[model samples]
Target: MATPRIDLTAAAMLLGLAAVWGGSFVFAEIALRELGPMTITLHRVGWAAPLLFVLVRLKRLALPRGWRIWGSYLVMGALNNAIPFTLIFWGQTALEGGLASILNATTAVFGAVVAGLLLRDEPLLPRKLIGAALGVLGVAVVVGADALGTLSLRNLAQLAVLAAALSYALASVWARVRLGDQPPLVNAFGMIAGSTVLMIPAALWSDGLPDLGLAPVTWAALAGLSLLSTVLAYLLYFAILRRAGAANLTLVTLLIPPFAIFLGWLVLGEALPASAWIGFAVIALGLLVTDGRAARALAARYFLHTVTKE
Candidate 1:
């Protein structure tokens, strides 16, 4: 089977989706000051689910019925939204926004590995393995060698964020295998609705009832996280997933760090060290390697030269 390709339109949507998700780290950091991690996850999916339902209605899209479909939605919700969102928010409590985003870049690494194992068409090429190694090296560089010497709570928090990325990778593969044929809006709606179901009780058990007297800024962040990041982001996510396979969709993770770093610096005054920049460049090179287009072009050129010489 041939490798799936992402068209330019889908690629643009993926970048837009990455920007929106990158901004979410900043928003989560802001909201964490006023709310617990579970509370933030609750409100994000709770608020987004209704809006997505309304969008489904407006589009006159038919939602899939029956427990089997809803069950799949529940699993997708856990992997995609509830679990990852909560973990990332908790991790952000201990990590800078840029660091959290950089850790999240592991989603592509995990996705590539997961897709290679589970997806027949998107095999694990030698380039992908080398790229993943480079990506891992880049992450270690960004995190700094000194920091790795101690296994502190902060390192654990970083691990949690990495785990969240892994969850996202799994969710992408699950969606491709199970709901690839479903409408993007419908899948988005169902997943968020299912997330709300899981998150509401989780919030109550972990954080008690949410405070109704949050400051205006916190509320604004919540709205941005729910509306732009969760709702609209997932709409774009499923749309791109339809056009691009899971591995391609995960490339958005590679684009997220820069947007996140900029927002963190501008809004939160979080400054990154030189190592982080070097690591980001390494990660970018790894992504290019993972893409394999340059290697393919080079091979084509060599083949043409040989043909002409012959």
Candidate 2:
């Protein structure tokens, strides 16, 4: 099958989605001041799930029914939302949001590896291997050689965020194979619903009930995280996935780091080290290589024209 081309509209939506997702790191940081990681993760999905169901109803879309579909939703929720959200929120407690976002960008690298293993259509290509290697090297650079030598909690937290990224990669592969035919909104709703179901009990067990006397800013941050990042971002995500192929959608990962860093700096006065910036560039290069756009462009510019002229 031919890949879908990303038109200008889809490109715009992709960028918008990247910005929303990137901003989530900043919001998570703000909300973490008052709420526990479990509470934040629970509220994120709990609030977004009902709103998404409302979207499903208003659009008159059929809700995916049956135990099998709900079972898939439960798995997706665990992979995509519950695990990642909790880990990321907990990691952000120790790491800066910008750094967390850079680590999160590794999702594509992991996704490439996961897809190559799981999907018959996406075999492990040479370029992908190189890209994945570069990405891992970039991560090492970001974490610094010294920190890696020690078993510090900070290092553990960073690893947790990367683990979350891997979970997202696995979830993406699962969705492609199992739930590709479902409507994007329906999938979004179902996954969030499943996340809510899983998170509520976990939050109660871990954090107990959330404090009702929390400050307004924390509440606002929670709302922003749930409404803007979780709900609206997924809608845009599925829309872009429909119009553009997954390769094009992966470009959003490249766009996220800058936005995240900038928002963290602007909002929280957080600054990244020079090494983190260098590592981020390397990761971006890996993403470009993995996406095949750099090679394609070179071919179009140099090889294709020469061959066609002959």
RMSD of each: 3.0, 1.8
Task: Give the distance in Å from residue 161's predicted Cα in candidate 1 to where it truly belongs.
Answer: 1.0
Q: For candidate 2, lDDT tens digit of each residue in 1-310?
A: 7579889999899889988899999999999999999999998999999899999999999987799999999999999999999999999999999999999998898789889989999999988888899899899999999996699888998999999999999999989988889988998898899989999999999998789898999999899899999888988987898899767888899889899999999999999999999998988888888888879899888987898899
Off by over 4 Å in 1: 1-15, 238-251, 301-310
- Model 2: which residue pairs collide? none
Q: Weakest 10 consecutive residues, lDDT, candidate 2?
A: 241-250
- Please give the CA lDDT of all the candidate structures: 0.87, 0.91
Model 2 TM-score is 0.95
* Candidate 2 local lDDT, residue 133: 91
